[model samples]
Target: MPTADPASLFWFLFLFATFVWPAWERQRIHLRRLWKIHELQRRRGTRVITLIHRQEALSLLGIPLARYINIEDSEQVLRAVRLTPGDMPIDLVLHTPGGLVLAAEQIAAALRRHPARVTVFVPHYAMSGGTLLALAADEIVMDEHAVLGPVDPQLGQFPAASILRAVSRKPVAEVDDETLILADVAEKAVRQVQDFVRELVADKLPPDRAETIVRDLTEGQWTHDYPITFEKLRSYGLPVRAGLPREVYELMELFPQPAGRRPSVQYVPVHDVEPRRRRHP
Candidate 1:
């Protein structure tokens, strides 16, 4: 058997310590930084809960972001809220395209049940399911360009407007039986959304007012994709304010922009075509 060299083993150990120690230390610091941020927000008021759907803008390396809201997400949020004191208020920072209706309701219910106030902040936009969540909050804060979308529910691949329109345009007897059934379901789906919205804001506003706002948002008053900007939302008699908490902007900086969106490297001249390597013969 060959004997191991003490000198070779010593250099190998030195190399490992030199390269690996820095990376390990950096990882610890990164985790600690995130923990400190959570602690800071917890001390200020409620622990801030962030829900960002993978928007094209937030996509990393041109890879789409994961869908924003889902059943599993609500469960995770429930566990997080329960970990904190019941009396503590919550600040939900939302950016979503909306998801399963049941999941949104589950999260909304949890927010309403919290003993303290719930505030939702939208640095960009929150649509559909996201709007459902914001409605559940005691107050909603958004940047001027931030928007919330209409709450009309979509059925499978069908749009609510198209389904209801098709049924209404043709006589009930003339319409296909399946189409009629879809139309009926669409009507019910709309009503459910309106009712849910009103109920979410009921504690904050009078019933009549809440119903009026909910109706406007749910009754096809706007396109499903319409950007209901912050100013317009304030007009709906909702408790909406302009601007987000300071930390939201600071945190936004931590996300990496795709290379195309980032500034050109300083070493590369603006007018120069990027250099490419030649194949060797």
Candidate 2:
């Protein structure tokens, strides 16, 4: 028999080992580790940290359903964190679209209760509740483009419903009356949000200053691209500082103490925790 074509044999083995075997192995490893983490969470009481993103109607593939942090889920995580030894820090990686006000308040309260320091990492934007959660953190780390949104409470109601109610109740062509009614509605919405901001931030800032900040953030012409940048946050009399990505990276390597030092939460990419697989030719 012609000596087995050495090159063909090598290619066959290489394909089997590099392509087929590795793919199967990777899947197996992924599933195994996923199960292991679940079990570990169930068994050992460790520092429980969660990632919250925007709410989507549906989740694609294995992507996590993003929404404002769920109050219930936050409670569960807080319970777990509370179980962790007091000496261990609870590091929460938060990226959120800022969800329900009540939920955010609950999350903030839980963060406050934990004996260990709560460190929040904002790799990207964390608006509304995300910003509220960051306030509870001993330190907050932000990337260059990362932002926090105005803590404006957006009330959701059908504009059509409101207009119909007004039309049914009031005489037509009373333009001045209609304008005053609309202004009143707008003021109520602004006041509601201002009250909440007062509760969260007033203790940290002077009462009058806090009220003024809330008014500007909520009453100003809203913009989708608006950002509560570090400069703006400081100007509002909140304790905030600029964080460079490079500085955070170095700090992560060093793992310095957070207290007294400026809050230095690091933005860790998901790939840093779970790297992508390479394909074999």
Candidate 3:
């Protein structure tokens, strides 16, 4: 290796420090700004907008923190909803894998208490406890492809986890015993969930229909491609209709519409202020 020229090395180091360091720093700053923007869009709302990212579990374990709400924190969300200005509609966005049943009910009850119309928008999937929240909404808006999972309640075992474990444990021979036991366990769990959901929906849906819905959701060993669409929900005995409410429609017109078929989930942050534009010359 050739000996370095001290002057040249100094100049080169200075150039790198002046140019490369600033560029790298700028890139990092830009990235941080972009991340801040995204987080603001996600959580910067004051209007008690609650997103149930994952409803299946309370703690952040294998699941992402975005999913589910802690029951206690969820109550705070409820209090916010209750205390929100009555003049403005409450926007509740849900995208959950479903969570603790009792927690779900508490959230649902808080939603029910909102004097302003409660609009639920599901941009993606809302299953189990998430579905229960949807039921409490005055209006549920879902995209054509968006889905709401069955309200069938499962007991101690998280439905997805339990099913996966059972499938994995199946024996090559004499699997009947294992299958039966799992089925029985699943049935009881599902029934418990359905009963709880039914109680919540009794005031909104007819008693007999609620019972039937619960049975339909829980009785089947497992609902593959569970009923989620409006047509399916109606077929399953839920009261839902297509088209946005007049107020929701008007709100959509005021904001920058989301790209695509239209987001099934629409939430107006409590802190959102109407943008003002100068009058044209």
Candidate models: Cα lDDT each: 0.78, 0.61, 0.63
User: Cα deviation in Å at residue 90, candidate 2?
Assistant: 3.4
Ranking by lDDT: 1, 3, 2
Candidate 1 ranges beyond 4 A from true positions: 1-36, 39-43, 55-66, 257-281
lDDT of 1: 0.78
Better of 2 and 3 by TM-score: 2
Q: For candidate 2, lDDT tens digit of each residue in 134-212?
A: 7766666666567887665554542322443454575556657755566466556656666666666666678888877
lDDT minimum window of 10 residues, candidate 3: 55-64
Task: Point out the worst 10-residue segment of candidate 1 by lDDT.
Answer: 54-63
TM-score head-to-head 1 vs 3, winner:
1
RMSD each, Å: 9.6, 12.2, 11.4
TM-score of decoy 1:
0.76
Quick one: ranking by TM-score, best first?
Answer: 1, 2, 3
